[model samples]
Target: MRINKFIANSGFTSRRKADDLIIQGRVKINGQTIYEPGIQVVDGDKVEVEGKLLTIEKKFYIKLYKPVGFITSNFDPYNELDLNDLLDIDKRFFAAGRLDKDSEGLLIITNDGEFTNNLIHPKFKLDKEYIVKIDRKLRASQEKKFEKGLDIGNGEKTSDAKLEYLGNNTYSVIIHQGFNRQIRRMFKVLGARVIELKRIRIGKIFLGDLKEKEYKYFSKDELKFVDEMIR
Candidate 1:
């Protein structure tokens, strides 16, 4: 298997992260630093990342209905609530993407680096859906501007998005990119503030009626969709 794939299969991190480790001279093959990403490795060959021996582990696909006040983080120095604290799973799994500490909803957790890479990688254009409540109702002009794309400063602009009003000040939106605080920024530019934001969908996986802070193993059918999504 390729070095990056080997490291990812070992469940240490993502393939892209493995490549970074290789470039940084942190990855070694049989005691020699291996920087070539495509280099093949055999079952007998020793592989290490930062002096830690690489070993494969069972991969898991989990979905959690994250609630507000829990941050999607590996660690929190302040000892605040984190999504990992809510999980009762045995193995260490990382969130495919993230929801801010204030925001909440469906979160994907997995040990499959390739899947994470593909889902978040810019090339794949995976769809993410969010239900948002703004401080005020949005106008048709503002919705059109959002659909056309919003300039969120920093020389960055949002991609074309699909928007739907869900009554009152609430709305549903779908976007293909995972920009940081994107939904908030979009509404901010239109003179509104996002008071509540919750992700309900990623690709074909939906939150359905999953209660907050509860998680379930990904169904085989859902896993198949994830594979088909990246392909």
Candidate 2:
């Protein structure tokens, strides 16, 4: 297998991230640091990423209803609530995408690297749906501006998004772009503050009846649905 694919199969991260690691000279084949991501690895060949041995692991796909105050990452330097602790399984899984600390809702936890890449990579143009509660009611003008896209700072403008007003200061927001704190930033650009942001769906997968901090493995049908979508 290719070196980047090998690293990804080891459950470290996505193939794209593995390529970044290879380019950074953080990947080694039999103690020789290699900056080439396309290098091939055969059986019995030793592969290491960031000085740690890489081994292919059993893939896992889980859906989690992440709660507020918990961070998505495994390594929390600031000693905050970690989402990993909620899963008691032996396998290590990372969030396919991230929700900010204050955000609550659906998170796909998986050890499949290619799967992670397919879900979050901008090239896929996957729709992620969220229900957001703002500090005030959304104005028609601001809603139009949001649907047409807005400058969210740092010279980046969000792609056109779909905004459905849900009443009571809440709206259903759908965005394909994965900018940092994107939903909040989009609202901020319109002089609105997102008081609550909860992701309800990613493509065909839904949060469903999963309560806060609850999780469940993806069903076979759901997995097939995701596979078809990504393909």
TM-score of 2: 0.81
* Model 1, position 19: C-alpha lDDT score: 86
lDDT of 1 by residue, 55-147 (tens): 888788888998998888767899999866889777777899988888989999987877887888878778899999999988899999999
Off by over 4 Å in 1: 16-42, 229-231
1-231: candidate 2 lDDT, tens digit per residue: 899888877878778888899999999999999999889999999998888998998777899999999998877888888975677777676788989999999999987878887888787788999999999987899899999999988988998899999989999999998888999999998889999999999888899999998999999878896677435
Provide the lowest-lDDT 10-residue window in model 2: 222-231
The true-versus-predicted C-alpha distance at residue 153 of model 2, in Å, is: 0.6
Evaluated against the true structure, the overall lDDT of model 1 is 0.87
Candidate 1 at 168: error in angstroms? Answer: 1.5
Angstrom error of the Cα, residue 127, model 2: value is: 0.5
lDDT of 2 at 27: 90
The list of candidate 2 runs beyond 4 A from truth reads 1-7, 12-54, 229-231
TM-score of every model versus the real structure: 0.87, 0.81
